[model samples]
Target: MRGVARTTAFLVAAAFIPIIALAQTPAGFEFQITLSKQAAQRLASSGEGITVQASYYGEPKKGAEKHVDEMGQIYLGDERIDLPGKAATARINGSGFEQAAVKWLDGPAMVNVNIFSSRKAGPDNILSCDLIDGELQVVRKSRFAVHCALIEEGMQTELKP
Candidate 1:
């Protein structure tokens, strides 16, 4: 009888081990952007250029997180603009080509990203752009600079098993 009781207790404990592990799994996030037809065209035109810079804020677990900057130069007769596409782990993933993950310490982590462009690359060449309401619009000389939008499915993180 005592053996039977011990066996039952061991089974119950074993069943909860996987549940506990799952609960303790950490959470992660990813970011992505999609360009519109006009935006793509503008980015592919000669003498046109665009730059995206992102800064992440969070706790100081492994010192200060580094900023990420990407620049795209458009050329005449170009067809496509190569933009970075991949979800970066909320935390530093040790990959030099990815952004560090967000760290929630005092509150929710925050990521502030700015996208700027110029008809011709140089200093103070910030083109007016707006990314909201599911639309990306850039204006220059009181006309459309470029058009873009967030992908139909918004950015999300995939859970690891």
Candidate 2:
């Protein structure tokens, strides 16, 4: 009976090994990028026609949390934000690329992001923030500090009432 009990304990621990490993995998990156008031308005009214080309720069900011789900949905904590087909791509290292399903939460001054599965943070990272809402592919702001870190992704985008 004692041997049987020991075997059960061993099996339970082994069963949990995969679960522990899965948790450590990086889900995505959350970035809080500053944009001007007019820029914010332009992005908001773009109607899912927006995409940013931000690169990993400097150290990660401490104030952000995971705002995008694995299903590529955006949220603010428990409440979700609506942005359908908002998934887009962001390039890094000038030419090298990664596919990211982007969704944002913007206001009068800033734009928060969940660019799916980005590269690790490092210096000398220059980001070109191309706001494609309008006809021109102009990058509105340059030298904006990217505040961000890796975070787990999950949540559904809900329309604001």
Candidate 3:
């Protein structure tokens, strides 16, 4: 039993020596891919049953801009309204959707999302909406708000058709 235990310990230590040696030597390489807001928007917009296109960083990205036939419905509160323009804006007409149009910018990524109005259900307020995969997701969080200063994780359109 002792011999077996010693052998196991020896094997484990020997196996780890190579890893420890490798850790001491640093392997460094620099590779980067850059995408602008328009490119990201175009990618996120191609989900299905939606038409979303964006031009950013002097480059434009396009995807399946076709509207998916069977998309989930979003129930935007009466207070939250989408404004028409290249720079989209959501206005909160009342407290119900007051925070819906907040925009948050983190590093190279910008997020725009709108919150649907909340309805008071028996005990809790319900903000109801199904986010269709390919539907346009506008970043409506406020940039000035706290905890919004870091680079955000964004979803890009898949390269596949």
Ranking by TM-score: 1, 2, 3
Instruction: Give per-model TM-scores.
Output: 0.31, 0.21, 0.17
- Mind giving the per-residue lDDT tens digits that candidate 3 earns over 1-161? 11122111100101111233323322101111122344234323432111122211111123322311133212212222332211222222223321222222111222223222222212321121112111112222211111000013332222100
User: Which tens-of-lDDT digit does each residue in 14-108 have in candidate 1?
Assistant: 11112332233221112233344443443455355654443333343333223222322111110122232111111211122122233312333
Model 3 sits at a Cα RMSD from the real structure of 24.5
Error of 2 at 148 (Å): 14
Q: Is candidate 1 or candidate 2 better by TM-score?
A: 1
Q: All models: lDDT?
A: 0.27, 0.24, 0.20
Candidate 2 lDDT: 0.24
Local error of candidate 3 at residue 153 (angstroms): 8.7
Candidate 2 RMSD to the correct structure: 22.4
**C-alpha RMSD values across all candidates:** 21.8, 22.4, 24.5
Instruction: Report the error of model 3 at residue 131, Å.
Output: 13
lDDT of 2 at 122: 26
Which has the better lDDT: candidate 1, or candidate 2? 1
lDDT of 2 by residue, 11-71 (tens): 0101111233223322222222333333233334443232333331111123332544453
Give the lowest summed-lDDT range of ten residues in model 1.
7-16
Best by TM-score: 1
Q: What's the ranking of the predictions by lDDT, best on top?
A: 1, 2, 3
